[model samples]
Target: MKARITVMRTVGAAVMAGALAWGVVTGAQTDTPPQDASVEAVADAAPGYAVEDYNYPQADKILAEKNIVLKRGDGHIVLADCASETGLLEVWARSRDKICFKVTGNSGWLTLEIPSVYGVKGSADQTAQVDMTVGSEEKSFDVAKNSFAAVGESADEQGRDYMLVEIRTAK
Candidate 1:
């Protein structure tokens, strides 16, 4: 009876070992090329990384529609409707009657082009500095809060027309 029991235990162990060996052989026999190809395909389909250039959005559309050439900015300063708010910075140009911008945050900057700019109306909360140029000479003007300041030809001794190129403001 003991010999029969021992034989039965040995048979059970052998069967388990054979099953494990068969499983390993079967797993090894399966082709890995398809799996590698699927991984490569997934990698190729992945999207590229995003980057920010700080350029103004819809600039070309705005230029075509409103004739305003907005270039780059820190996003704190943005073009605004003149009638929308009272504290907006107002720019007076010969080419255009009036252009307005809203300033936010601790500081802001915008680069643009407005020919024949002569005056700027300051916002209530922020002090502003405008940069303008005529021919090869450049000039800067400081505008007080909530006040109108003469700039470009209005302030220039020679009364040369100046093109506004940049605006900077701080709270």
Candidate 2:
């Protein structure tokens, strides 16, 4: 009778331990909390996306400060103080005198407006092409590296004034 009671107690303890282990495993597997409406609402609170338009930055301030109407560019060319550095492309116009631009990268382009442009001085390492217009007619000039080239009225037989509109350069 004593042996039977001991055996039955041991069996009961084993069954209880097995049940506890199964409960622990089932609880662990379902530990993740249920999703609620608050979780969905958090997604709407995130920030929006960003986009780039490529328009010239601070153009109005530049125009106000320098009297140059900078329109657009690939960000490879920019206006610079004439005395700031050497090897800058120089644009000569009757109204603006000499304006300088610094060129960077392998190639670049800038579109701007400078009236009465007659000549361009190219940078040392890159050749340049200048586009001008007078009335409805358009013209293009090739400027050799590190040299002064006549354009606009100086190049035209009729001596018509031209507005410098665009500049393209390559290394």
Candidate 3:
């Protein structure tokens, strides 16, 4: 019985490995865009603010490789603005998601920016908190005074992993 169990485990691991391999190959294939298209064309299709101003060096490369355009701006990174501008705010995978923004517009009025997939985990008030896990580590951050907080392992630290952002409005 023990020998049989060992054989079953090995077979299961092999199947999982095969599926992961297939995902890496085929998943990557579908993301690539046309070779002849210009950078402008690629930028036009990206979500977020303006592609030129956002300074996510690593994300830029990833998006480019995937043929996705991301809108970025310099001064204020408002979640409402991004949502209003892009319309499709929940398009990224959990692992590669990060919220980057600069506070702008009204002093009291703020836009809470987070990956559309995760949604708003807490209230929109001044003091809000949420729990998120990236890989094996779990952490929590508070939203206060219109600040930006991201919950994801750094690319440098952890190859690639899920991240959550919690934006809280000031009271």
Candidate 4:
């Protein structure tokens, strides 16, 4: 019985290996079957395969802790600690103690939801526009480069709570 079990395990491994080999061959097939030298070229990673490389880093951890579902960005705008720096984009919130974003590059964009955001600071070279929503009403604000500006509820005399939805930057 032990010998039979060993044979079955070896057969299972061989079957798995063959299946993997077949999948690789079909996935890498171009107009022609991949030959020895052309195999490497034909097996270039698929476009769909490369997309996952750009996923938000540490996304699961961030989402679990912050309740922030940061989906995707251009890699130019990213979350920053409260005391990060002045020359980058800064977000001041009423409820949140520490909320900021570090924006690099001449042009960048990000989409997120931070409730009760009241103000923002923009970098000198990077003019920024932010989209916010208060209830069903949506508002946009233009923050001059290198300056601080009131946004969301801070701009309202009623002191309504507004959620910052998106951020765009351009040179």
Candidate 5:
């Protein structure tokens, strides 16, 4: 009877230890939280705004400082200080003696404004056409390569004030 009792007590202890180990493993596994199936959008995933690279640089500053309403231009034509370089397309005005543009490449076009220009001097090897405006009238003139040409008020019969508006050049 004594031996049988000891055997039964040993069996009971084994069963209790097995139950405790199983409980510990299950409790450890349940510590991880569950994930939901619902989806949601986030604000940072949207696209960002950007500026166009082709737009002219410092255009607003140029307008404010020069009093020039330079709208746009092909990269081939650009502003220059007079006599700084050769083969410039020069705008001679009644107010300012000259405004210069460095003309390069074989062909180019620019839209700009010099309030009272009356003459244009062409690049060394390229012919240019200039557009001018006076009141309600618009006119165009062709300038020869490497030479001066009358435009704006100089080309007018009544010699009215005129604004230089455009220039297109070709080799």
Candidate 6:
């Protein structure tokens, strides 16, 4: 009788452990809590800023429209190619002839690069200013994060443009 009791207890423990493990796996796969509806509504209102697909021309045009040039020198365009290859969405904005980009991916990393003609100044907590020209446009911008703004409508000081890129991994 004692032997049978011990066998039943062992089976009960195994079943409970299996149930607990299944619950954990399933919970992890469940969707995250819904985001704020107001935020979603605002996002819906701004379709132009949306990043739906990442395929060449579409991606290239999106960046170009904002006067952003990716992969100017060599190496890689950083997030540009990765965003396209991985089908992630990104946005670019040009302020004062400088380019600022932000990317949000389904998984992995998001990167931004800003070129500085005079190189970045100070530390991350400090502000950095850069001057440059895009075509006939002259501009200057103060970079708080990884961004670039032009100084004025003038030929690139060094006759070459510089860029700073930032990448962040998504959860």
In model 3, the Cα lDDT at residue 36 comes to 89
Q: Which ten residues in a row have the lowest lDDT in candidate 2?
A: 31-40
TM-scores, one per candidate: 0.72, 0.71, 0.24, 0.65, 0.66, 0.22
Tell me the tens digit of each residue's lDDT in model 6 across 1-171: 999999999999999999999999887686665576333456567555775443333346656775444423222123334233332222222344323222332222223334443332222222433334555555544544333323332235554444433333222
* lDDT string, candidate 2, 35-110, tens digits: 7623356767888888666577899998998888889899888888889989999999895659999988899899
Which stretches of model 2 miss by more than 4 angstroms? Answer: 1-50
Best to worst by TM-score, what's the order? 1, 2, 5, 4, 3, 6
> Judged by TM-score, which candidate is best?
1
Best by lDDT: 1
Against the hidden true structure, what lDDT does model 2 obtain? Answer: 0.91
Rate residue 51 of model 6 by lDDT: 55
lDDT of 4 by residue, 51-147 (tens): 5444567767888997665656788888877576667678888756656678788788777788898888887578899999999999999999888
CA shift at 55, candidate 3, in angstroms? 35
lDDT per residue as tens, model 1, 52-171: 898998999999999999999999889999999799999999956699999999899999999999999989899999999999998999999899999999998899999999999998
Error of 5 at 104 (Å): 1.2
Better of 1 and 5 by lDDT: 1
Q: Candidate 1, which segments miss by more than 4 Å at Cα?
A: 1-48
Of 3 and 5, which scores higher on lDDT? 5
lDDT of the candidates, in the order given: 0.93, 0.91, 0.42, 0.82, 0.84, 0.41
Q: lDDT for model 1, on a 0 to 1 scale?
A: 0.93
Q: In candidate 1, how many Å is residue 94 off?
A: 1.0
lDDT of 3 by residue, 1-171 (tens): 999999999999999999999999888777567798655667668777754644434555645564333333332324322334322112233544433333343322222222322322222324334334555765565544333333343322543454443333233
Q: For model 3, which pairs clash?
A: 46-69, 49-71, 49-72, 50-71, 50-72, 77-102, 95-161, 95-162
Alpha-carbon shift of residue 83 in model 2 (angstroms) = 0.5
